[model samples]
Target chain A: MATQSFKTYFGRNSRQGLWYVPLLITVVGAVILTVYTDDFASPQNLSNLLSQAMPLIIVAIGQMIVIVIGGMDLSVGAIISLTTALLALDAPAFVLVPAVFAITALIGLVNGYSIVKLNVHPIIATLSVQFIVVGFARILRPVAGGSVPDIVVSCVAGTVFGIPLTVFWAVIVLLLGWKLIHGSRYGLHLFAIGGGVSSGQEDAAHNFGISDQRNVILAYVCSALFAALAGFYIAGRISSGDPGVGETFALDSVTAVAIGGTQLSGGIGSLHGTLFGAILMVLLSNGMNLANLSAFLQGAIKGAILLLVVSLQSRKKMGL
Target chain B: MGAIAANPVLQRAIRVPPAYLVFAVLLITLWVTKPQLMNVNVMGIFIRQVAPLGILVLGQLLVMRVRSIDLSGAGVLLVVNYMISSGIMGDVPAIAYIAMALSVGLAVGLVNGYLVGRRRVSAVIATLAVTVILTGIIQFLASGKPPGDMPGYFNDIYNTKIWIVPTPVAFWLLLTVLMSLFLSRFVFGRFIAAIGENPTASHFSGVPVERTVIASHILASVIASVAALVQSASVAVGSIRLGLEMPIDAVAATILGGVIFGRGDGGVWGPFFGVMCFALLFVVMTSFGVPDPGKQIARGLIILLAAIFYGLSSSEK
Candidate 1:
């Protein structure tokens, strides 16, 4: 009976997944970094770290929503790039900001419609969209030097009442993510749909009276919206638009979600786990930089980590 | 829509790979607008430029047939390019270079096969991670070194012609033929087809599904290495810039040829023509003065439209 309970807690089929494992790893990693590096414990460095990790955490939370339904979104990076470009245009804050959200929602709608209605595969659909979006972004900005609205820049620059404004951003984003992934009926429905899709019964959730198609579409839209939010934050921080700024976020967010113990096959993940995953990635990078490791070698190490983490989570299906 | 779906002729046309249609359309467009550029020598030069891509598509089609994919071609191309150009191998003979390149390909292929076939990881993530790792290592090694010149022999071989066709173009065609024959004549071909149709059914029917997938991945990686050799030879010097676009183009071309996950309606020649379409596309875009971003958008649109065509057709069936 004890073994059965333990298995239920950590089994491959468990809905919660082994999320605590990443939490444990994150704590351990943080402790090690704190001990080994003098700068890690400093207040300024900690604040900088929070800001540095905020965008990824925001993006990963959104990515986890789609992964829970057994779909991948490769266009998030491009959407982020497009967001910055749109924001950097010589326009008012109100117009530019709303326009960014509207454009991203439209992109998300097309992505969701292609996969859900047109029967295109998620990866291929989003990959094609990625190219198209990036091309448009390049046409808009071409290179990285355009000024953002003053209000946009100020949102990320200063502290609020002895605390960094980044802390407030994290709190807001995390609450929103938590509500979407853990607090709402839609979140439960997403897991139900993903559970069915991963088990080779693509219609299981639909048979249970869940509007699976709409939910899946919404998930993609949410993912895109989150990417846009991250792009907004990045643009504010940099005070400019860059066509290539978000190039790594798509893969990086995937890595963060996967490291958090979410099954890429779907239906098993946690918001806390994703938070820890993003933190772990940022921590690893920070520690590496402090250790004076070669920047190029850091990429290889991260790749190895991704491979190692994914290899441990075995799945039934073999292909893309 | 219902009427079109019910028509026999329309059904037959839908079943045909779009690559052939696109190829014909592009050929006519070129012939009509730029008749002078339609000569054999000019076309040969254009076709030769895409020989590496054409070769890469052969491997891509094989893996896609079995419902897997290999995006590590870019990494393999980069590593091989670095090896030949960086002179990191310490003054090796030509045969030694060939051996090293093949060995590297073999090693990468085995890792990919193990990860995707045995470990059952997502093929995209596994192969993409492999690419990142390889690219990172190459960049690290080539950090302080300047781009180096290629051995003169490679350029010489690249320029050679066989009966008015560039050697690389002929070689690409020869490989495509060999691939077609191998798929038609060997038991392995049957294995791949069965696995693609249904993995569980193939397993119950006593097919070695895992082994077959692994073998296909190995072959694909080795073939990608050969493509890399051709790509490296075409360039005069080695630089650290990533050729990530090549594998993506190969994926687009393969899909254009009617080869999606677990399907191969176009076979080898369809993708051969798909590569031909790309050659004409570049020429057309250049002559029209389309910028780089425009070309990127065009490439994306082509892939999207082609995949949508297959998706609709498959669903109808």
Candidate 2:
């Protein structure tokens, strides 16, 4: 029955249906906002939404890659929190940023090592990493007192000719990420790893195949790298590194990735989809604020929309 | 097969659960550094405080074994804590209060089960979404106020001791025993193990895989609600943020207890000891004047160790 329904939908171009639903939801959301608030489509709000979403988009893109390779990086939020705290302690931008990036990469290596050598599931493994990093974050800057250097903040926060600095960073991260995944041999290897690493190389003659173990580690490193970068952006935005600020991003990033149609079970998805999902999420949150919904209600609304999107994605993949 | 038995040295090293050993080492270090810290009377209150988290871990471990998770416990804890203190069930008998709380837990669990089991939703996402909704609903209801003074009677009961042990501790031990018996002696126990090991195979073998998974989740939620009541009763006043860390902490403690995804070795006893380990950790930290942030770091490190232990164990298997 599921196959029959899937075939019927495909016969009518079901792939097109995916785009329509999210688009329709966005349109309806826009309409509702326009009806309710005079500043619904104002230029400032539009820019603010994208700017607010930029960090999450970077993180989501990273998360999307890891998830596609059949793993998760639960420590991204903690990494961001830790990096933000680190950035606050008056270290030079040149030294601090690179140091944080390296530390994050080390964490990713630890995560990858545990997943590959120790054989722990991604959920438990990443969750533990999150705990450790969050704890370290508190230890580093228990409160929101440390101010990121003005120079660094200005760089991240400044506009580039008409484009927001954050937007520019997003574009750079997206292009680099896309090229790595679509342009390089590493990309093909990742697909092979996700497709069943053992079989893909064992059966094929054209194997530029690195071990699945290596891919897993690299994926986690990438996740941490992006998360740390996002942390820098967040520190810029807040002007002060807050220990607890990155707390919500754990759930939000997951929701964004899932909404972008990345299967939680892994082996499928595109960074492009994640980019759209992040935009939609930011817009939705902005729309909710305009609607005068409470912060708590806004969260619930995000989760519900996430549920609908993920379910739709899963169902389509299940050929239902 | 050769790796399993040929390495006698490796086998010896792997015999005992690492967390338990770590707990012992930490305990001894603390005892030596501050001889007065190990006294039962001094440590008892702190142990009692973490009992709520320990109980929540038991439920968390069970769900995790079935290859599922429940972030909704925090939300369930928040709402149930509110219900008990809100005067919503005004002047209800103590037993009735307990019953009402349990029912609320079961209801939330039912919804969670339907989404995860029947609907085939991602367990983490589904439970997380439920948590989001529940958190919102509770916040909307409370208008962001501490719900009410936890009825005085609950505080009295929670604090009471049997012989030397606190009531909550005793209650946890009893529940663990009953849970162990239920899992080991009953058909349901076998079903749970079978389902966790391989859901598809269990289904093929005539087990009601979905039903077992759902039932475990519901049972786990019910246990969490009970923990919330005990937790709320321990506190003098209610707060909106009560039990916010229960889910993650429980996950940590449970993992420490030797229950990793779809496999449990330490069983009830393992998690029971894990809770005791947490209790002792707090005692040690406070005695040494490690400060709050230091304590958080310690807790996180312990959790990380548990994750490492899980990875090591599964790979060996």
Candidate 3:
């Protein structure tokens, strides 16, 4: 009876004990870094690491929202590419930034329409959209040039009361994203839809609720918006846009989401877990570089870790 | 009956694929625009280049029919290509080299099959992870340098022609014919069809569900290895990179051949013709002097079209 109760409490669906693994990964990474590099303990090193993590963190946040709705948005990479291209354009910042954001949202809307109205699987639909958007980005800007103003870069790179400006902005985005996902009626529907669409629809019908179309749209919009934000940060980091910048974002974002304890089948994950996953990934990359590991071996290691985390989550889901 | 047979829509539905139709239209258009593009030799050469992709698609379609995918083609290609050019065999006879390469491929296939079929990992994720690991192993082994030369025998085989057609193209067609016979005539083929249509029902009927799936993956990976060999022989050297476009292209072409996830009754020959369509597409594009970036865009659009087509078909079903 005691074992049964203990199993019940610690079993797969429980969220209370979820923070342990991610926190462990983070602590282990930091300790290993400190041990390996003398400069790793310095404030500069920590700040630099956060800055490096900024883009992926933003993308992961967006990816988590989509995953929560039981779908993936592979088009996030294309959004990043498009936004980066927009940033590199010679147009004024006010025009360029807002236009890029709007364009990204529009692309998300198209994705939502195809998935919701046309009843397409998220993976295939988003993957196709990714291709189209990437094609457009290439056609529009074949060359990877143009620049972000130094002033804007300095502001993003600057610190507010010893906290990085990017960190502050990231916090705001995180809060807004969390509230939108966890607090709203839309959030409830998103989770429901992911759990099972037929039952979800029945539940919504009973409650005098509307279709989850709006939630789907919001999720994709958030994904594209966050991807664009990451693009802007990337622009600031490089002070220019390159088509190749987004080539790795799609795979890495998926990896981050998976490692975050989010089920690829959807509806069983958290932003906090995702944040942990992203940090773990960045730390692994940093550690690999520090250890002078070959890029291919690093890739192998990352893939192994991702496979392990996902398998653990899946096994738990399967009640194994 | 003759008029009905000649009707365009019936012709389309009964005859090969719309991709072939498009390929035909484009080929003719190019020929009319530039008569210089109508050489038989040029067309044969172009068809020969895409033979590897054609072979890979057979494996892809087989697995996809069972509601699985194999994106590990690129990794298999990388490793196999590397082995051929690495001089690892070091003066071993050609048959020995061939045997070793196929074994490596079959080993990889076995691993993928176990993970996906037995462990019940998501097909996309499992195959993709396999691909990543294989690619990494190849890259790690190769380090940063270009790979060494393929064996003289590999080059010799690649360069061989029977009559006017390339040996690889002939091999590709022979494999397709054999696969068609297996899928259409054999008991295992029937079992595959049954399993693909509905796994649970097939299992209840004692169709050896797990074994069928595992074998399908094994066959798919072996085909990919063959593709890698042909690809390496054609290039005469292996590099860190080879055929990243292949798995996705295989997906696209399979769909274009009307072999979507749920419906593959269109059979193996349809995708065989789809490979010809891709071959023709490259011919048309090159004839028009379309640049590399333009080719990229075209490929992207084709993939999108396949996805959209898949969406349309599935929703209707």
By TM-score, who's the top model here? 1
lDDT of each: 0.90, 0.76, 0.76
Clashing pairs in 1: none
Clashing pairs in 3: none
A59-112, model 1: which lDDT tens digit per residue? 999899999999999899999899999999999999999999999999999889
Between candidates 1 and 3, name the one with more favorable DockQ. Answer: 1
lDDT of each residue in A160-251, candidate 3, tens digit only: 78787877866886787678666687766667666553223324522545477777877888898899988888887788777767876777
Model 2, B82-138: lDDT tens digits are: 888888887888898888889988998998887777777777777877788788778
The window of 10 residues in a row where model 1 chain B has the poorest summed lDDT is B143-152
**Each candidate: fraction of true contacts kept?**
0.73, 0.43, 0.31
Considering chain A alone, report the TM-score of candidate 2 relative to the true chain A.
Answer: 0.85
Per-candidate DockQ values are 0.79, 0.46, 0.35
**lDDT (10s digit) by residue, model 2, range A1-320:** 99877753333333112323344566687787777778868877767777888889988977877876757777888888998899898778788877888999999888888877677667667877787788888988988877988876897887778777776787788898888766687776665565552232322312543667777788888888888888888888888888887887877888887776566656555666677778778878886776689887776777777667655544211000
Using TM-score as the measure, what is the rank order of every candidate, best first? 1, 3, 2
* Candidate 3 lDDT over residue span B1-317, tens digit each: 45665667755564344566666787788778877757877777888999999999989988878777788888888887877788876777777767876997799899878777777666666777777777777788888687888777777988888898889998998989998998889887888778777777887998887888888899999989888888888888778863457897897788778776645845887787778778878777877788666776677677666656556545544
TM-score of chain A of 1: 0.96
